[model samples]
Target chain A: MSDLTAPGFPGEAVRLRARTGAAAAFPPAAEYGQVLFGAQCGTPGDQLDAMRLVPPVFMPQRLAKLIDLGREPLYQDVELGTVIGGFSSPLPVYVSALGSTRAAGGDLGLALSRQAGALGIPMVIGENVVPVNGYGRLDEDAGRSLLGRLRAYTEHLGDGPDGGVAVQQSTEDADAEVWNLVYSDPAARPLLDSGRLAFELKVGQGAKPGLGGMTVVDAEAAARMAGQYGLDPVFGEGRVLRSSSPGTFTAEILRQQIRLMRNNFPKARVWVKLIPGRDVAEAVRVAVEAGADAVTVDGAEGGTGWAPSAFTGQVGLPLAECLRRIGEKPPCLLVSGRIWEGGRAVKSLALGATAVGLGRAALLAVAEDQQDGLIRFVECLSMEMRLIVSALGKYAPGEISPDDVWSP
Target chain B: MIEDGPTQPGDPRAHLSSPATRSTLRIQNQLLAAAREYLTSAGFTEMLPPVIGPVTDPGGRGSKQVDIDFYGHRYKLMTSAILYKQASLLAFDKIFCIAPNVRLEPLETANTSRHLAEFHQLDVEVAGASREQIIQLVEDLVVHMVQRTIAALPEEFAALGRDVDAFADLVQGMFARTTHAEAVADLHAVGHDQSADAEIDWAGEALLSSKSSRPFFVTDYPKGSRGFYDRESRTEAGVLRNFDLIAPEGFGELCSGSERTNDYAEIITRMRETGENPQKYRWYLELVKEGIPASAGFGIGVERLTRYVAGLDAVWQANAFPKLPGVVSP
Candidate 1:
């Protein structure tokens, strides 16, 4: 540890830590987790933004399309439908893991779920929701609970075989047996029967690469969760900081965990979410080899409920670097960071991402208009994807290749 | 009905004269005769089932329905006669149908060793029967069918390499009864990962069936696992009064039956809950509203039973002309 008062040292973070004490380690996400993220604090070296989708002058796929259609082709001729991590999705995008943070847990969470369900895209409910909000309580307000989000998602889910839901479990959530509860809950029967449910193993998130989930809990809830979590009185009387341990895992542990998931929830799809670690490519290979249906890579630019701002900006590999590191055609490679627009999404797809995850952008969209904000946001992104793909002389999202993206 | 027309290339009739198929047909005929004998002796009236209807059972577990244009309206090929079995109870206390069904099961199921695109079912219904009554009825019917087939064609069993002792436990009343939750627990204990709230998945079902020496009834399936016609328990909020009769030695589910719901309000609510449009089920709902009797019934797949009894490798071996999920055959 270097001296904090060195004349040439970067002094802003240290000075802030001095003023706020232990509280400075985590971002002020309770006040601005859903809204202000990605606008100001983002990975400064995002290579996805550096790449451009360059269209060809000779459009043979479009010519083939013309012959197939017996006329000229348009951007609308592009089809976005794809299978994401074993779930049929109308678009090559999904609602990423939004957990039981204060800003995302209640009505807004339900609203986001409904929109995502109606859109016929898979939605991942993030970690620690069960431990924090109670699995579900009918006697009390259950709207913020994990079951509440599932019910909300299934309510507007369409008749087509498009959408599904994946429930994530952290170490604390594993203690609650979140997967077993959802696997047996009557509320999840529709998805289970239809083969649309999945269980996501939370290895780590992008925002905090090596740490567990962090949330600001009220004193009463803090006292209740004190046994399961590391509860620190960093925020004084009314508010406390709750920290969960990032569960230990080796390659073999990951392999067996996926095997256990497959054996325990045979009806449900198996998903493994990996952080933007230095060895992300190896982790992805290990997960895919162990029979994971989908392996999600959350880049350093990914958002979280609570994490240190330093980690958010500088802790892990950017999504583009992760994709480059993983190389070509890893099955069901789901990458997420600051994926808000079609340009970055198309670049990700070209760089070998099977699909892009909408995280903070989804939260912001839902917060903007709880009714149809996500729907509109997706509409714009999808339209842009179609236009870009069609211009590249391709008619499907999966047809995008590295040849189409120009790094310069 | 044998056809006299010119045989097309790759016709299934080419193999009809084979020894294996001949033995299979012999066992099938005996099973059919035994089913008719057993049901009629129990005071069940035999009725020809309608092959096309405005609405059919919507709980085929990921299977698609076949549709045809009937006059100006769209009609669906029967997946199961479960709905009409309830209506048939209006004229008779007990009824049975040698019914034909068509289901477009997922292409992946073609390798499951138990699925067929076209098949027949021995559909049976009894008025004023409880879930337990139906379970007992299915058990007895299965025992009788197996015993009759063995007695009628002992040499066929030997020729097909089917051991008569394989079904001894069934004939000796060794059929076990387990709840859906228990079955799921059993699968989980073996690392099968079966969902407790849904039907046992295909692999899990096979695992349980293989472990049993005798046929067993898995009862009290959760509400959403089956169609709305399966009655919900008044005592339990989400448990349905239903059961599936699984065959031994990994033959998988042989029969599925449940106590039928005749209350119009409950039927409508359940229909909506299961994602079925009530308007499409208008005729059935109207009949249900007119006070149909409380009944319990089940449909046992004839091909599946024949396959199990003959110890065949696949259900298609039991049929003269097989139609696998994605395969086109005569």
Candidate 2:
């Protein structure tokens, strides 16, 4: 094994170890057991590369833009600004949902929030944080509670923050009243006032489509909740397997849930996160018809948390196919999977996606520089997006048509 | 064998041997007799409850069903007699059972007085009945049971510190009916978060129960939060024809009933929608295909009912061989 693959870095040995007891030539190593977190983690991006975007040599969109901007060959005034889930954003990009995994929650969560705030793009705080961590004034400087992520997201944001924070609730988080607490908190008053707050009903995620949320907890916590949740003590000693219900959903059920969200929390925007299920297109249509402001599709590639090995590649439809199935007429479609660079983001935007979510890419970008990592990473992506969109002769993300793409 | 105060925690036999346990058991016997007398007079046949089945209710509330090796095949311990209740309709139009159930409830729920790993339910079903009719029957049955206990065991009530007059309103058949939407709105108004799509969660149920002074019905839950057996409302889209009779003053839910979805194709579709393997329900599906009666039924938590009537602090006090969730007991 090479030195880079030895332990701390991403290399061939790591990939082999990830595939585990298989062979030298194998799939890339992911969360099956590696602890080294960065952008280069988890399973492959669910083959999003199946769809390609064609950059035309002609420039009609540029001429139309010239009419709009009242100028010439200058695609400089391209409007990247757009609305996502009822909130204004400078670009059609948002941070994908982040669960309370050890690698992502707490400080890293705050970092993601601060950077997302800086970029003025929306962020989704995933489930189990409140039940695992206390809902308090986290610290003098950093509050790590549900409100803490909100505060961090808003703190670094300059005047007139464009994007918002969407609090996503799983069955467990629902039990703990994650959204209720956030919606009523004085801390979120500013966000609500700015019309930049949303509550995402977690129907499914890309990692484990039909499965519930799973985590490894110690014996004490397990014993405390032994009567309320299922705990498989497979790890022995202190460790045990704890799981939450996956939540059941049918077509009528999806429609009714959205209506309920609208009725109960009338002040906030409603969003629904969907996994790439077998009926991805239908689910998207159901969500849209039910009046969802945004329907996020977590592609099979973007689960950054710990999940069982069986689900990573074997389960759920890929992101590209999900987008393709949702087809040309998009409904505030937000897509995510191994999307850090602008090329992939642009490709997603062209293939009937209203926006792209940054999952591992956002986390790793922060891990890359801590202070300027995410900003620099986003800047690089923005640069690529401008260059690519300009090449397509379209400035705004909405201008990217299905005619600009090929699907397989 | 009636002994002293504040019984031991783990072994229930010690508690059962106590005077408090004796009184509780006496009241419990009256409750059973009262239930049987009412059901039998109301033209219902009582049967011995089944211990295992080919498949059980997919209690999606995180509770698990125990599976045993039935020779080479797998059989599950009955979580509730719901499926069998529907099947039993073939033999008698109205059937009832004092059935035992086992649920591997989540560990954390051990604290809630509402949950238990092992318990009994007064399961009732009636063919060609509407959800409204069953809910009325539940109210009548509960009133009859409470009145029977009050008349037969006045001393038990006095000893347990419950006023018999507290049940007067029930005897008069006066109860409030709250829809799922109204209940959710109430919860939100009181600063609680309840999913409008799902059932009123445990805390929300307790809050609503605590606020009420008398037994009330929370009805018409949205589809998908319950088992596939609960029939969806044909007239009202996305709503189920079901109701949960919540015990007043924070005792939580005492009984849940719904109009059964009897159509075979619909049942299959529902099973798939609920993510259950359709092949596992071979026996029940075959019965459905052969046309089980259209029924509406409910399982009243016997211990919970007794706890509410006796004014006991916890449900375990109502059962001799009480099994608290996650607790090892006799």
Candidate 3:
């Protein structure tokens, strides 16, 4: 009868009594890493011997959905609409995390965020943005700061507030209390109020597991950073090794970190990014138990701003393998590494992923045509996704299951 | 080992050479000499450590290894001489060395009082020895050093305000032995969070160390938390048959040792599981493939031991030429 829904309304039970008269109706509301989870799509998708999607002739779930539809169902009836890490999305894809790439800095970052928001899917703003670019409230240097991305996302966000922006915090960022700063800032109030902000605690990346971030800097920069990082004049006398400390997370530390996030900022969602280490499944369990809204695992194929060449090729587990290792799904499992298309996306979803992240693919799409490039790319993906679901004799993205594909 | 002294720019001479650091330095020297005397008496031969090698230990806490140009080939500075310790087993069943190590530890470690950019370890390897035997050797060696120091120089302890009585209980008797599970539980009981499946973190380790009244062994660290050589336990699936010796009164980890794996197949599996490229360990892996002796050993941080013994403020004080991580010093 009234606006009151939840029981024991904190501010006033008197107003609830006035509306209900002890028998009134109450309306309720509900809310819901591949390579950075792209597998190595090396061969040009034209393998005559490549594996194909295999759907059973007796589609029990599809038949059930068809019965629910009160008629024979087609591919178009598939409810592609799903909630990803608390954000509503038109499709099951979200822009994967990206750091301060040249394209991720000023105008390009803004454009990408705007487009991601318009697409109604969530986006993760990756590490080092706060440390390299500034936090939004201060000088931020011509809108290349962390808050700049949020502003871009919020400005272009359409009427329904379907997308959220998750900002990742590395060890350096955590040392700077990036989450605390952003959570408490008035500038971020809009995103907070709209429930469109999340914080991703970065444990490790796929490109380099068990190692910190490594980058080369010129002699001048090295001299300045020599006191802050472990520097070496490895590339001759002119260049130095500038390394970042990886965030330490044993199972307990991870649990406590996620708990701390929930306690400190009740309004924002908590996410964790893990390198597909040998114990990916264990780490995922710990994260989910600690009340994380989502957990992202990046396979060894994930890219980074600065990583050793050896690490990229040799270090983490492949995304597909990581997913297979995890086996069963937690409540929300997001993957990335090299994920860019429909078949792989469908395979990942069928393999128990809640959603898939678009990393380098999103960037390249935007880079090729900043205005409509991403739009066209995502549209084609949506179409392919529909086709795959219909071919599987299922109508929803989430319905694509382990039964839909055959693996060796 | 260098004892803590005043640090000023352009001061070439060690502050340890000064009169104020004399007593601490004496204790430091005694600790080393006592270790040498004990190990040699125990029939351990000493080896000179290599400064550079093809690869170094993949320091798990994200400590970076220093790579140098070794005649146009990429060579890493010795982060730990554990690999060399294993190789030396080919020559001597019992080997010891006051080996130097360089670890580009994270900047945060600079504040922890236990870390040093350049330091030494009293490395001892015993071929054909069990984990218990090596742990017993450590106990005996540590006791002998302390008793020798306490008897030889009581005034040094007084001058440095270190209580000679700290070694009274440790003079004779095996130290406390706690499993990694027990230590984690103790930490949790103290209102601290510790990982059940990873290495006891730096903070957790310090917390446990500070709470102890005597030096203790925390054994059975998780398999993935360490370098590949630490042999996995047959009885325990997830744990390595390794141990870390934690100093009393919050000085933190003094040393780490483990039962080394000898099987080629097992080592390769461990290597891949740890994300280590087996190729990087060409020489060491060759030794494993060809068959090296099954042994157990530990390396005690020379400076860390000196700090705990002399009651110095930080590990840098134990160095004659210190490299306080991130600080440029000669």
For lDDT, the strongest prediction is 1
TM score of chain A per candidate: 0.88, 0.85, 0.84
Instruction: For candidate 3, write residues A1-408 as lDDT tens digits.
Output: 112121211113223222222221112222111123235565443211144678778878777877898988887787788778887788888888888544566776777787887787899998767766677664547478888888777888788858888988776554344665666455567887788889887887887888766667788866655434567777896977777677455675576556546644566888888988989999999989877899998877666356777887778788877887899977888988666567778888888888889876666556555675567667767767887888898888877778787864
> For model 1, how does the per-residue alpha-carbon lDDT over A1-408 read when each residue is reduced to its tens digit?
112131222234333432333344346757765755443445344577877689989988999999999999999999999899999999899989988777678887888899999999999999988888877844646788888889889999988999999999887775455776676566787898899999898899988999999988899998778667888888797999898887776675576567556644667898989999999999999999878999999988887377877887679998888988999689899988877777889999999988999887677667666777678778777877888899999999889999999885
Query: Looking at candidate 1, what is the lDDT of residue B76?
Result: 82
Candidate 2 per-residue C-alpha lDDT over B98-139 given as tens digits, one digit per residue, 9 for 90 to 100: 999987665545667667788899999999999889999998
Highest DockQ against the true fold, candidate:
2
What's the candidate order when arranged by decreasing lDDT?
A: 1, 2, 3
What level of docking quality does candidate 1 show? incorrect
Stretches of candidate 2 exceeding 4 Å from the true structure: A1-250, A253-282, A285-342, A345-408, B1-8, B189-191
**Model 1 agreement with the true structure over B1-330: per-residue lDDT tens digits:** 112312221356666887878998999999999999999998999999999997787644556677577885658899888888889888899999999998776555677778888999999999999999888889888899888889989999888888898887889875899999999888889898765656788889989988999999999987656777899999997788999999888889999999988899888777644434465577888888889999999999999999888888788878888888767677
Position A293, candidate 2: lDDT? 96
lDDT of 2 by residue, A319-369 (tens): 877877888666698998777666678888888888898877677666554
